[model samples]
Target: MKFSTNELLPLVSRLDQLLRTAEIGDYPGAFNGLQIENQGVVSRIVAAVDACEAVILQAAREPGTLLLVHHGLFWSGAQPIKGILYRKLKAALDGDLALYSSHLPLDLHPSLGNNVLLAKSLGLTGLKPSLELKGQSVGVMGKIKPMKREKFEALLCKSVGGRVHLAPGGPETIASVLVVTGGAGGEVARAADLKVDAFVTGEGPHWSFTAAEELGLNLFYGGHYATEVFGVKALARWLSEGTGLPWSFLDHPSGL
Candidate 1:
């Protein structure tokens, strides 16, 4: 099956509105839209957390594929398009791949976002948006039935499908949790201000452990790559269900 690239315009417009891509403030390098165009047609959709060279090359295996990702190319800012960068672009162009990226926009999306999906997976209730970044609430705070901190950690570990680093700074029992997936560990202080019993995030700076302890906040560090995979997968599934386009996820873990 194939779809004209023009057929993607409506889908892209719907995504832009659904994610509020234009309204949301993100890193200048996010470039949160269609970063590259295909040869005016789409054959399949590929979703991944990052648009690294390996994933791009994998997408290139199928010509006319739409590569959807959370982290786009060019996070490090402009540089001479040579070496790995050059190879990546060449592969995409050669394979007629279209690349679309959504960083903060996808992270904060209410129903289909990384934070919300993870929160739901953890069986959280009373979820509300929290943790402002760039003038938008990029995380979720919610209630979990009080449980022993160790049990809570185990549940989180299962949900994220990896080992979790815990700074057990809060009480023995945990009832409330604030979740901001992917590298938001620096927001420990802000989460502390929210007075939630625990904060769950991807990786953070080294000092975040001490800060969590001092601030009386339990911290769970699920791997950054693990926690962030939800949004892209959810988005791809959504697009497939809506548009009847086949989609696949490219798993490239950066075990950070």
Candidate 2:
């Protein structure tokens, strides 16, 4: 099956009010939708967590493919088209591969978002939105079956498919956990204020270490790259279902 590359715009527009890419202040580099344009047609979709050089090079092998990613090509923002960045652009241009990104948008989407999937993976019940930013809740908070912190951390590690960083500050028995996937360790203090027993995120600053201990909130760091893969996979799958176009995920873990 194939779809016009333009079709994705209308399909994803329904999510504008929900993802709020325009309103949410993400890293200036996360330019969101359609970072690169293709030759107006897409027969295959490749979803990945980042648009790193390796992923770009790989996608270039499959000409005219559309690559859907979370992290995009502008971390350094715009620069003279030279060096490695030049190579990435040249590869996409050569391959006719389009790149589309969704950062906070992917994180907060209700049906196919990162936070919701992670929360569901942990068997959280009565999940409610939390960690509001830019007038949107990008995370979920909810009750987990009461259990030891060690056990809950183990479950989280399984859910994220990576080893987890646990700062044991709260009680041994976890009553609730709040999930904000990817670089949200700093939110532990806020999670503490909400009376949750545990907080889960990808990575955080070193200062967050002190905050978690001081606030007595169980902090779990489930590698930033690992936690965020959920959204891209979910999104590409949805597009496949809707368009009948084959979709694949290019897994390249940063191991951060």
Off by over 4 Å in 2: 1-20, 75-77
Clashes of each: 0, 0
How high is each candidate's TM-score? 0.95, 0.92
Name model 1 segments beyond 4 Å from true: 1-6
lDDT of 2: 0.84
After TM-score superposition, the amount by which residue 61's alpha carbon in candidate 1 deviates from its true location, in angstroms, is 0.6
lDDT of 1 at 24: 92
Q: Which run of 10 residues does model 1 get worst, by summed lDDT? A: 1-10
lDDT tens readout by residue for model 1, 208-232: 9999999999999998999999999
